[model samples]
Target: MGLIDRFQALFRPKDRENEPATVAMPPPRPSSVLARFNVEQGRRATVEEARRMYDEDPRVRGIIQTLARDAVKNGFELVVEGPRAEEAQDVAQAMLERVDFWSRIDDWVRLTLRDGDSFLEVAANRQGDIVEISRKPTLEMYVRTDEFGRFVDPMRAYYWADRLASVSERPPDHAIYFAEWQIVQASWDRDEGSRYGQPLFASARKAYKRMTEGELDIAIRRKTRAGMKYVHSLEDASEADIEAYKQRNQAALNDPFAAVADFFSNKRTTIQAIQGDARLSEIEDVLHHIRTFWMASPVPMSLLGYGQDLNRDVLDEQEKQYRRTLEQVAQWVTGQFVRPLLIRQWLLRGIWPDGLTWSVEWASKEVSTVAVLAEVAKAVVALRATGIVSDETLLRMLSHVMPDFDVKAELARLREGRPDEIWRMAQLAGGQDGAA
Candidate 1:
């Protein structure tokens, strides 16, 4: 079959083909008006507001950037298994390259966590191959699903607001709808049974507000009250006298040059520096709020340079914890975004293997995964001498030792390279098994 034909077959299952992508949903406008109704939604902060924080606040920006950077810093590999596993791997890699997937991964990762949800639009060429994978604004796109959480018909996903050009042609919020398989979505910290993903920084809003305000308040206080605001008190002086004194020193109060001009005064005005005010030594409460803001997000305080007293042991512990976090984030990305695109490319190529199972593996950012997994591989390979574990099983087990190793293809190569040796080894393993 042709590429376009296969593409249609892959996404349009017989049962779901007749159904629309969406139905009976109201027009989705880009506004926070619905926020009042869904008070508990996204920790009471609208997705729009969260996006603003990402742009304006350094803390929010840092947290999201850190998540994206740390998540993909080590890179990942796709492991495929099936009769045509090698072909599938080759095709998937070529497709990813064509669309510049890795090159623009930062954008995808940011979109994944920017508004607590990510929406990706898959664009295909005339030959029905995916050529572009671009991000749609999470704030503008709306998803409609049935009671079972499955997509409705052509309206499964909609993008942009209802168009001003023609309401009839683009009725669903005037948004152009996408097919079930056309859009790839990834949500961060999503709430159960909710359509939209919970933004990772939703809970940090209040603390961020306090932290930012505290810093600003503290800054203003330091500049204004950090030093003495001299009080020139007049003892039994008339209003005219006080007015004359102010008129004379008004320039000195504002301008340093004018202060040098304060040569003479009628009375002995003892201008004592205002003592015991704006003591910055005791603003622990504001610091507490700053720490609280960092604590609210997934990015650890140490990751953002907050813990000054962190020792090597403490840092190692934090690194271990962070590695675990990255693993989870990688899994979510593989499942929601990466895997689906691979499958889509497979279908577009019309050579996708049936019953194909695959996983994306990552190199560790902290620990040396190869050395650690190599030891595990050694243990697994030892089982092969017993004749119970097959060579293929051993290769799969050792797959962690080398991220790009294709188990099935490597097994085939070994069989081709040394047929007699393979047979002899099998016989020897059988003898060992019998002796055992």
Candidate 2:
């Protein structure tokens, strides 16, 4: 042997018994509503169990096995079987017969997955289009995905069927009969006209009658997802509409919880379009664009629409003559009155002014806070003679100006120094001219 090989061999331990085998444990399940289904990690022995169940209960197991195969292929589990299977299927068929099977199925599927993590969880209803797989969830709340088979929508046919199976396992044939009753009732009342409808109806009627005579399948089509349709199946069915549907659905499925991100992204695209005024016809065009892109969204539509309406209202007000007068008044308040008030407040704080006022012609004069107060007092008295604002309105306006400046406290302090100033303000309000 080479020297290198010998060196490695010297360190090698003598062989003994092989290490004990360890069965790999399944991954930890997150504590979430999705865990309720108890989907087994890997294939496990479910197929075998299903097969054995099939052999033992051929009548029920037959359909269960077929559903199981579809489940495995579609990445879901079929939990319904026996009489329950017949009932849910009957109901499904009825729903399909009445509405656009595809559309109805999609709605039902969306409702189911609204609560759980289905592969089809991100699909949303956007405007009028069914966005199979959007970065954002659909308005209908269906999970969007790029691939049909990859993501499981809570409204998967397998899911609803599986739920039915579990109930059937517990309650016997009565559950199935009830499910049939529900389906038939909805189908009939809704004017469902499936070719198989009459046959299924007759079968349900016969079975229900037999139960009165004591031979009934007690199976229940337990609720899963929402609505009565299979939403995931629609996502899968979209595969035929065009290959892009499934692909898009799968992509959304890959990131099911990113509805906000998707919604914002769509919003961003719209905002960008309107940002450039050169591209749009006018401000109205931009506003309309926002309404279409932002307001039409499924979520917060009312909230967003309200804000947009308010903005539009303001714009509309600006166009009307009467409202325009109010608008100009507001502008004057902000620019002339409010701005000057703020500036005076700041200057008075620094200079410790007792009071201040200004000339309408913009000329300025001031000495101390007392002098300013005296000048404003005299001007107001003269103005009162001309009948501008009533004394009540002028007092109210003055009260607003020095709201926080404690007049009594300031007068007390001024009295300690210049008691004459206190008499001056008293004269302005009521003491001096008697016109007060």
Candidate 3:
């Protein structure tokens, strides 16, 4: 029977106990094609080849690293606010520092950016203290499904060479999965439900291949030696003489000095230099491919270390958009991976508090240069001068411009006749003008 017929038979309803008796049927034998399909489809595409190419290809690596670096450039903070808020925050911070969390997160981002999906197997001691967190290659891991074809929590993972490892073992709860992008509603029959991530550069594979081919073509063109066809009258020459001529010609071609010496001796020989085009067009084509790859990337060219001829306004806009993207990534990583890990740690440490709520805060995305801050301060002062904003509103706006601004303290000092430094500066300037 076909695979579909077998599936139907397996899932077909059985006669109820109260219903009429029916003969028990034997399970259908598995089809060879079905077995082969399961075996082949279950295996993920080998990432080593793509990873090797990514490493060797500077352009590819640059794009991937650019995206990854920007995503986690600002790092993140664990904000725990609840009954045990302070303790939770302290514990989380301590654990983060102990594990060098930022460095591990950076590695996770880079791997996911390059390989589509990155895995972190969380290892803990008997006391449930996280001992080590190591990255696992996507090629070595596989998903496991239950009898109902639903994915089993704690999926089966194994090394490619470990044929004896039982496929039925459930992965530990600490195994964290981070993917750059995933397809939704994909077919399970084709293993699309396996949660394997599609690499960002998978779409640009063809362009990369073309680029390599172009490079090879250019190299081959450069290394090729010009050749001249020799025509001689063999009518008067014996076989030995012809053989000797062939050997001499081969030797001369191998050595430029020998070829010049032979030129002086062989008066009957005519030399014609064969020339080829410089193939400068291939270089242009390769550059075009590189540009295409960059354009296809999610990151902007400026972020990938290409800032030539870029407008300041355009770059600022690109940075703003890129920062927003990074913020979203930070949110996703926190929700999907970091939060669970922290919660698990809390549970292990017996610090799991009731009604606990935690959040991850990324660094400010706005440009924080001195010039930018000055501009923001000017805007806030102008708004406050208009008298249209309330004192509370003015303080809130000023707080955004300067996080260290203390509205209540400043107000108390002003009420006590102590002006701010800026006010003192204005007074000094006015007194100097009067004295002059």
Candidate 4:
């Protein structure tokens, strides 16, 4: 049986057509005026609003982009360990390269941060050779749920079967479902038993709004100098003179020949500018709002280049803690993102339980200097001299030090005993594009 057939057989109950949702919103309270007012006006920010913030706000975009990019900055690879491992690993690696896996993964991270949930769709050819990988917009897509509000097998999820309903559809139908074995959801910071993921910046939305409004207020204050006003200084004069002066001042303010217009004012009025001081000199409050917004985001201040006030030691300590956060994201990528694809791809090819095993080994940035890498290379070379472990084993051990280390190519060259081959492979392994 196919994947869908299998799921149907296992989980499809008799009332498939009429399965009542066991979860729903509580009934509205009609008696309380406060409840009615809240129902009418108190709408919360949504996933779409978070996306808008990511696109339009620099601080928000910075927090999300920084976390997403740095988490994958080191790199990652699928390492197959046993029987037929080389062929499987090679196929998977080539598939990833063809689809530009690294760039696509970066996009996935960004979308997940923006939308709180993201999705990926992977497909193979008729011969079960892995071929296609694509990112799906979370807004345009959704998952299926059973009666209990659990995503029906979130790993190999069920797609909404209303089947690409019109965007104009109000309260669209998400009732029917169809199963696809090759799709996966990448969600973080989700509530238990909830169908959707929480966006990274969801909690800080109010702060984001305040910060933007503050910045705008500051700009207006600086540019316009907090509104202009005309103070008519009258000596001991009659009401007629005061009225005439007011008319003349109004004319000057409205005169097209004047340098300042209704909003901008005229110089002939001997004006005392005092129209707007709403926050003319209160810039410090805006700064405070900005700091609050940054503090509310998931990223640390150090990651966002916030080290001016901090000493070297303090910055270094924060850096360490931030690295730990990145490591956690990496682990999630391995399990939630990488492993699902590998397993589903294998299951599609019927290669399960064939004594083959796979592992994910993510790379880290080359913080080690040339001397350190050389020392590692030297140690590896000594281990190779013992003739105990195969060269393939040794290279896999050091693959984390350099991504794209060609294990098979190096093994062939070592067997051939080409004197220059080791140097060439070493250079290539270090991300040298055109090493001689």
Cα RMSDs, all models? 7.5, 36.5, 11.6, 8.5
Candidate 3 residues lying further than 4 Å off, grouped into runs, are 1-43, 124-131, 147-193, 225-279, 282-285, 302-317, 349-354, 365-367, 378-436
Candidate topping lDDT: 1
**What ranking emerges by lDDT with the best candidate at the front?**
1, 4, 3, 2
lDDT of 3: 0.56
Model 2, residue 331: C-alpha shift (Å):
23
Span of ten consecutive residues with least summed lDDT in model 3 = 180-189
- Reference-based lDDT, each prediction: 0.67, 0.29, 0.56, 0.64
lDDT of 3 by residue, 1-436 (tens): 7432332222222424434454553332346325433543433443555586678978678777776676666565455677778777777777777667777776677677666666565554555455566666555554444333433332222222222123334344544332211101111112343445656676667777787898887777665633343345445566786677667667665574444535232335445555555444547788788777666576777876777788999999988787777677667667555775676566555565445887665655454676666566555555645778754455445444453455557655656765455443433433322211
lDDT of 4 by residue, 266-355 (tens): 333343556666657767787787778776565777666655678889877877877778778888777667776766666555555246
Tens digit of per-residue lDDT, candidate 2, span 3-102: 3233222222222243235455343334421332232211113323323333453322323222222211211011123433434333333322433333
Please give the range of 10 consecutive residues that has the lowest summed lDDT in model 4.
35-44
Model 3, residue 14: distance off in Å is 32
Clashes of each: 16, 50, 0, 0
Q: Pick the candidate with the highest TM-score.
A: 1
TM-score of each: 0.72, 0.14, 0.59, 0.67
Task: List ranges where model 2 is wrong by over 4 Å.
Answer: 1-278, 281-283, 288-375, 379-397, 411-419, 422-436
- The true-structure Cα RMSD of candidate 4 reads 8.5
Sort every candidate by TM-score, greatest first.
1, 4, 3, 2
